[model samples]
Target: MLRRLAPVVLSLLVMVLGVTALAARPQRSAPPHTADFVVVAGVAGLRWEDVDPRTTPTLWRMAERGSIGSLSVRSAHRPTCPVDGWLTLGAGSFAAWNGNRPAGGCPQQAVTVERPDGTGAKLPDQESVVHYNQEQLPWGAVPGSLAESVRCSVAVGPGAAVAAARPFGRVDRYAPALPEDPTQLLGSCVLSIVDLGTVAGTTRAQREAAARTADAQLARVLAARPPHSLVLVAGISDTDRSARLHVAVADGPGWERGWLTSPTTGRDGYLQLVDLAPTALAALGRPMPERLFVGRPAVAVDGRPDLADAIAKPLDAEREAANQRAVAGWFYTLLAAVLMLLAVAVLPLLRRARRHAGPHGPEPVPRRVVAVVELLLIAAALAVPAALLADAVPWWRAERPGLTFAGVTALLVAAGTAAVRFAPGYGSTLGPLGAVAALTALVVGADVVTGARLQLNGVVGYSAQAGGRYAGLGTVGLGVFLAAALLSAGWLAQQVRKGWRPAVMVAVTGLAVVIVGSPYLGADPIGAIALTAGLSVAAVISAGGWLTVSRLAWAVMAALGVTIGLAVLDLRRPVGERGSLGRFLAAFGDGTGGLTLHRFSTSNFDTLVSSPLTVLALAGALLVWFALLQPWGGLMRLFGIYPAMRAAMAGTAVAAVIGGVLGGVALDVAGAAAALVVPMAALAALRVLDHSTDRTVPTSGRPRGVGSGVAGEDGSGSDGGGTGGVGPLGDGGPGGAGGATGGRDAGRVQPGTATSDGPVG
Candidate 1:
């Protein structure tokens, strides 16, 4: 009775626990000191080495007395741009301009503009166009702008003002005259933005002159500020080269005299641009809402002079070198895919040759040789994780990437060989495959839990230098790893003892969902959606008898339901803490959701048009199709010959492809999906090859008059030994399909026992 009730009780317990965990609010750290006002000087594309103490004494002094670091300006949708950077800093979220202009055209000079109520106001000549664009363009808002939380805010330049005015609900536009003493304005405005257009100067001499002027202006403001004022000087972007890394410095209240470190990038001298607003709010003693901001606070770290030097290099050189390496990596990946396809095409001929060679054949490759081959495959399977670990090795730091990659591959292969030789279940068909899948899941999951340190450097994982993602698994890694682990683990559970098998399957599924879906762990909205939907369909198919159109529909509906439920929970969090689902919903509410969709669509279209990634994706899809229909009759037939397991594999493949396509389209990188689907497809093909050579049955069709080795759901005659004849199930016995039991075994086959004659139709 207790056993029967266990599933129900466990299900309820898990659901309750999940809800409670999600509902808990995040805690904010107390600021080291309080500040009355915060000033942000926006210097577009300002580099540390460009500023000399003699020419820009103010900036140099601030760096020595405050905190400084490299500011990563990459955004979710595009490379860093000045307009986007200022907007993101002010809004505390990722944002972009629609590049629309007002119908009447922009103002060329200073002019008096009237509010909708007819009140006249003077606007800066350069800022008039920006003001017009702000009112005309459709904008996406996840949270109220930073200005909304402060008592009063001032924007000194057009770029700064455009972002500052976003949260204002009134129809008035005004530009207050700059005070003679810049510090005098601090008493009235709690926040201020001063844009110096530092990168606008074309020549070194011109740039130096502009820097001196900006420095003097900054000195005046600092001299006038109150005792508790906080100042943040940042280079929002390099207009000429958007991808160049820039600088950020923090001074005054609560900040220590050292370099900056952040959890987002897991680098001591690096902080993302999105972190600025949150750090300012924390310094000013404001409460931060959950999930609304993608960045964490930048903490002060003990000064590391070498770290600063490493980050202070010319942005152009660093970007050029990184781009070169990335291109080479992509080319190598494409070559590998082509080779995998070639191997698949040749597998059939090899299998046929083995079959024609009689009972002994060419005595199987020595165990040692086979083990070496298996280890190599295992290393390939773990390519992403291995690359991540390789980044920290001292030899990897020597800039000989090729040598480091080879060494890491060899090490992983050796480790895998040792495990296969000693690990339990290694002799079983699913053992080694399951072990690889499980290890991949564990490594990736553990990295995510611990701030995604290794993945931050992994070739296939998030790239900190590129700033595409700072944490969490990439779409491709998540989809591929999750699918492989689930299928392998589920199959392995079935091969073990009966009493704990069902529980094992349940546990595996549950753990997978928790790891991938939990916001604090994976923090990936799209991933959570895809995994929830795909896993649900796979689980159902694994438990049910077969896949049909109606069953498929139900499975899809169940998946959709789970996805929506998770999205709704994300929406319940504060606007600042909301994930993609919540952000999209918020944008949709204000009719700006179309822009977000357009960004995703354009990104996907660009990737497809520009790269060979699509070819890899198509190859993967074709491989899965071939495995299911022609070569293996599906992976299900090869494993335990259980119809339910076959249904599960088929369903999972469909789900993975669907998820991969959706992820590729949504994330705008087809390579991510290709990376995921290609590996699993190759594994499936390999599984088919392994089964074909080992099984005794004819390749083309079902057996003629023999019993299957597996038992029915009822488990009757499960332990029966061999019967008669030469059959695939076992050594043959008597009475054809029913074995020695005659007609009594018509609907059921004894487990691990087979008749000598062909199976009965």
Candidate 2:
């Protein structure tokens, strides 16, 4: 009874314990002392690669002496232009222009500054931009929020005016351009923002010239800087339509040479454009407006590599992210194609195998073609993890990145599949399923537990450039991890004694949940909730393949408890220490979460249509229903004979629903299940189809013929290698078509075992 109820009771208990422990953790230290003045030097399309020692000496010097990181310039739209970045920085929130792009891609920055009072300047159209972000978009950005937060501010160029102007378009002080000798301009206010112009160009030489000019301007500003001031330099936006990582650097008290990070993006060496506003406010010792600002103060952790080596890091990351962005869509299409081709080939190939066999009516298909199909299925099942592993290689730098990436992934899949399929005891249904499931679970689990480094910009993983996530499991990772973990639980249940099945399932799934939601690990609270629900289904089904109302109520309770616990846990963390989920909840509590649902709905809908995982999901469903669930597929028979497998399938269904709705990547869950479960189901179906072809039933296909070996659902047979050729993976005794019976049996067929002429099992 305790084993049967383990998942229901233990999962809830462990989550509570984890939360309690976190609640007791020590509070973090306070922030650095405030600066007298905060100077923001904004540049559009600045990249770390553009900072050359000789040409851009000032910028390079700043990179070496100050804390530097790659800036994620994501706003409400992809490829955030100069105006959008400026507006977002001023608002301290994600902002965008809803208008269509200009012919060259991004809209040109043409700010018309009016001399309102003869001493200050005003923006003519700044109010419209403010209204769009606050009223029309989900971000609720109010242009000039940074300037509004301070008593007075200064602006040097057109872009800077967008950032420093008041809601009604007034700037305390504004200049058309920087003067050669203007210490008074910067010292006019505690907050000053100056635009260094655009550094991105279509040609290398053009970019170099732009960098030189920006560096010269920066040098002049630094020379005239007031004492006890904090300086911030950033590539604030994309120059064109395509998004990429930009440069970020901070130099001030307690911000000496180190890596830059923010609570918004927990990972080191990464900060968002929104963070710039919060950083400016923190530098000037202003109180952050929780309702308006969605960013946290930036922190610079000590330590960095040599200047040259540190510079190459962001450059390399950008290359990989760009490569993945280009090819990720096609990779999903290829996976869908693989599933479709297998669906098309299965029936025809099986029919051909039947025809090749002698007219011994109802005999098993005897062609090696089945082995080829099974092998291909095995490779497809492990494709996600294989693709993630492939990221370790510089396939993106190859002359043909897409093709090179595909080939490398294929090689990895072949290698992993071969190792699993050819390992000892492969003949047993448990061996192949267990090995494949465990491998997938282990790879994804280890990645999430560690830093998920391989998942960054991976073909099947998320990129920092997207700005939706940073240090934890992305939707794709969630899908893969949940599917593999559930299946792995099922496999472990099979190895234990029947009475201990549900107990083991609970243990495995509980550990997986901890890793997925621990804040220090996967940092996916929703994933933890979803997986707990799914595994409870597996646990109940394994105990007895029934989902009564009582069991469902318990499962729902466990999931809900986890959800509330995660939310509470996040709320308790300090403002600058909370994850994305906590920040959302905080924003929601402050009334800004009103449009969050609208935003999520729009994004989820867009992903549903644009992602190729949708095609893969549709194809997988067609194949599963038309081929596996149908009577002829033999999978239905296997489920009845193998309760552990039934438990795995049922649990996966529950997970898909919950994870998809909450994680906003529904098709990813389906695709992951299709990749891992479909192939294993196909293998099980093959065993059932070839059940009678082994030595036990023989070519005579008669019920009373000489009994050879009948491979039970567990693949244990009587004696002798069965005549069924399931490749080198199995022998008819104890493990499948060539399955072997219990060791207790010598050469005799076990009692109560079914024959070709009798009912199955």
Candidate 3:
């Protein structure tokens, strides 16, 4: 044993020594002045005019030593300041391809087309398609190819310094294709990868953290400096004030038209963002890629050039008209319709309070306030449907009228009536029923108009028309449906408060709608469509649970109807499709294929069974479910279960079962797991639940610690002359009861009792 221990100790010592020696070894140093080339780039939301020369002396110094010019950005689709900044520094072709073409010709990107005779599809392929922004960073692709093109030891990416962590290397090129829904995308959409402004400007605390992260990245780049390094420094010099300047530096100095500068008065604008990329590439001694460069870099122009001289000149009559027609005609109409519905529904709630109250009457009950609040909540009801509609529209057209008006009016009316009548109260089964009817009508309408296809593609737009973006109207419709469902649920909850039967009726009504509407809205058969519908249903249900029953019901009903309406819209097709139900259903699923009865057993089953990560996620979810179980919980009590522990366990089991169903598991396995796992997990998780339950005694239990003046535990008499009770410290004294204890001694007495100074004492 001693011999063996000795050898082991010796080995450990050697290992430690080896590690120490390795750590002490000097690191290899970068070669000095043996650079092939250096490249620099800039980022968006910045302009040259706004940059204070004194604030950025290093940039000025570099400019004096090297060439500075305004960079022209070339983009395939709509003009994107961020993408242009990132790609200009990515690789170079020529000035002509820099995304700015005076003639606004065909996009630099390759196009594919099929022959009229259907022999084969023709592919106008280019040498290599370089996606400067979207691909390199976020997608984690090796940027070595980009580096090799410039023959540089290092390549710095383009991004706003204040806004970027590294550089603006990755941007959402598809943004132009996104829908133009002010309420949905512009107002509420949080596409993090695409919206760098939000990411950078999240909060003061977050910005500080981001700044630190950026500093660390800069340090890393400096440490890894190779001979032929490409340093692309892009970002706003400072965005704290009104004036903001964008600067991009490629290489160190002395590159032709390499440096670009942009200035903007506002924090975020387009022009400044467009100047950073090509300038940086020029610094690297590589000509701007023909596919990207359109004209001169920003700094190249001593003053702002005429609009005509800019690389991205306006399109001529026919092209511009065609582009305008796609959105201005149908998209604007949809936006108007959705906006109108919102205006009509929300404006009435403010008036409800005045109508319900009398000048001198007692204050309204919590229920009445809830009713008033619900009326005001029309905006919330409209929001989800608008989002759904936006998702339904394709990126190309993005906006269409068909999706906006679909079921919106009926949903609004149903929600309004339910809200008003139930003021300080809640909706009844009738409201939800009405909502379901409205959604059904809309769905039926879509189906009929689509030629009886039953394929539910862009029907309402929000229903998942796969591979499409910017379907705004569908989003609005979905919001309506959810609002309706939530309203129904709230109404039932209120009924339950008054009497269990009414609540039960309301719940049943909502469940019925879910069962029926789910199919029509493509929430059942088509996977993607079903997913959205189910989520909408769940969201409304949760919302109803949060507020008072009456309030909940009205809100839910409005939300539900809106959600369904939004879910059925299709943006790719025109408004004419709105009047056709046959085409609508055909889009949901292949009509010729009928309903895919075997999908559950085949595709869905196979996918679920094969993924281990999915299985682990399911397990984690089960743990959370068990952790929330409570037998005597309010939910269980509402259903008549008095035992809290039992109720909690049952809830857990139900939750687990639901989770399993959502995870698309086999019924047998889900059932078995629900039975075995839920009970055991619930038992283990009971500790947390037990702690959360209130431990306070009932109001009638005892007179809360007797005041100083009161004697007996009942706290009835004055301390001065009444029978005094034992003091808190248990000193049996008359003064201790009220005077010494300071209850009645200081001339203070209980509201109904007179002090010793008064005759009553």
Candidate 4:
């Protein structure tokens, strides 16, 4: 009982302590000076020979108002060093110990070194840093760096103790203690810090002063600033074109002091400067978990998020570049799939539609010619102002601005002109001119009044915003133009079916401008209106082209059926703002924009309708060619001249019967069988009946009047001397049942002749 009670008491005590800590924590707030945040990163200068303050603002900005310093690291005594600046910033470590790079190549022989106090030290040369393991500096303890957690001595070895007590280091002492918790370090670890000046030429006093400044600045900011939201600019630059980085806190106005330095070698100075980025971002409310030597930020920061309330940035430049290269293969594959389907469905139709359009076939009007004409019309209309009204006064221009709507509006006006010109008898120029003038007035008025209206609304609603210049009047005018064009074409097609071809051409012309001038639409009603108008124009073109040859009623019924089906399919697709069918329809009603329905499944009927008018034209082609069987003995009968035709027909019938039985029966299959067999059988039966009748008639069945000295008793002709084979009318002339005579007037009848009301002989 006491054991259970003890556990309960301990848990309660822990919970209360946590509650107290939570309540006692200070409220977090960003310092005032960080209101206007800016980030300045320093990379190795590409033009180191000409490095200047103007060229290296990141280094000088801190150096001018502040100071500069170098740092040192315990690296292999070689030359070249390469490590990311950010990694050095994180864990406050330098490449000397934290990073895994040697200065240059290993020495060729054993080398001797003099310690700071001039004591002799000797070591054999090696090819890699692995050889320096025994000689490596015991920088300090890192709390979590060890595989096994173990306590470490707070006291350094005798030689190292003297080194740690030095006032500062331009290169050596600038870095932070390694193995994070110096007291817990069981072995050596990499250290990180600011760069003091180089030890090669700097005095002890100068390096010591730099170190004190660095330490004081760090302490001041860390104490006063909130735990979050800070930036530190601590680094070194020299009169020469060389530079180094250091550590300093950036909080509020109070701690805006300068840099610190150390007396260290020039090579070590460069090694220590790589730590700035990771440390700065870490202090500024960023997570830095992973440890890297130079540029690697800590693992804690997996992704870079935008400022708390700022608009998100675009995709990372590196990621975008990689994706562009990857997407090309996929794009080409989709294109190939669409093209293959088009070829299979369209080739047959083309062959058929052209079958009976006379020689030279039905010529396809080149899309290029229409495109050129449309472009010329737009250019000419736009050029009018350059010739006449460009410099006109603002008010006058607004009242009669001919150029603004000229590109799209001109084509409609021209089409209307051509319509009147081509119409029989009731043609005039006034109709088109009046239409253009009215459209211009409506557009100009809307453009001028929108600002005033918006101002009035702003007074009342506080947030009323006038649309952009081309939005109000321009879009409304465009909508009206497109609607009128559709209505006019519809009417013309009704009047004369052939006239519908021109309407199709005109709408297709408008489509070119929409595709080419998409950028001009802007970001408001104007763009939306343009999109709607472009699509509606395309629909009209499709509808008009279909109407060219098909009966109007058939075309209308098909269009209506297709429109409803498309609306349903669109509703089924996953929808958000752009793809939502409900919103698309609403937008259509409001005359703003609309959505196009793409084809889903394949059905012959669906293909014939949803496909271009080109397909219907092809179907007509089928009628022109294969349909010859209707006029000239149904093709099977022609083939019937060969007895094999009968066998083919019988096979078809058997297949139809089997299919019907196995498929649970379909009326269509039985009807199909009848269509295949009945006509050929009827024609065959007619020929057989005519042939049998001819055999029954006789050639000498006619009488010779019974006298007058001839072969017969009448001596005109003899029955035994008469010709015998059948005559043209099957030997069954009007004179007698067994008659077969070629003469028309002497008891003979003509063959294959039709009487007044019917076929007769």
Clashes of each: 26, 20, 174, 46
Please give, for residues 655-760, the per-residue lDDT of candidate 4 as tens digits.
3333233222222232322321232232222222222111111224334421111111111121212222111222312322112211111231233332121121
> What TM-score number comes out for model 1?
0.72
> Which 10-residue window in model 4 sums to the lowest lDDT?
459-468
Give candidate 3's whole-model lDDT: 0.30
Clashes of 2: 20
lDDT of 1: 0.53
Q: Each candidate's lDDT (Cα)?
A: 0.53, 0.75, 0.30, 0.26
What lDDT tens digits, residue by residue, belong to model 1 across residues 1-761? 88767754664455345434433333434344467778888886676556667878888888777888777776433555666677677767665443443332221222232234332122233243334333433333342357665656766665565445534332122234345776555555777777666554568887778778777877876787766888888887655543555778888855767677565654566788878877777777776644355566677777546433534543332443354356336633744574365446434432332221234444443446444444445545555555445544433344665665557655864675566547875554445556666666666677777766555445545445566555566654575556555655466555544343334444565566566656566655565555555555555545434456886787677567656666677778766456666777776776666766665666567656654545655555565566433433323323333322443355345545555455544322333333433443344434333333232222233354343442322223231113231122211224222222221222433323344433321
Task: Give model 4's TM-score versus the native structure.
Answer: 0.18
Question: Top lDDT: which candidate number?
Answer: 2
Q: Show where candidate 2 strays beyond 4 Å.
A: 1-30, 348-363, 692-712, 715-761
lDDT of 2 by residue, 1-761 (tens): 87667654765466566555433422435556569999999999998888879989998887788899999998876778888888888888888755677654786747688986866899878888778887888777777788989999999998898889988899999888899876888998999999999887789999999989999999999988878999999999988878889999998887888999886776889999999999888878888875788887888887789778888888889999999987887887788788778778776543332111233444444457677787887888888889888887899889999999999999999999999988876766556777888888888888877898888888888888888787877777777787788778877676655567776777777788777776667877677778878887887767444578987887677666666777787788777777556776887787767787777677668878877777766777777788777656666655644566678778887886677766776566666666777777777666554543322333355333233354344544312234332221222122233332222222334334455423222
The Cα RMSD in angstroms, rounded to one decimal, for candidate 1 relative to the true structure is 7.9
Predicted candidate 3 versus true structure: per-residue lDDT over 145-230, tens digit per residue: 23333321221121321111112222221122123331222212111111122113435555544444443343333343344444
- RMSD after CA superposition, every candidate: 7.9, 5.5, 28.2, 34.7
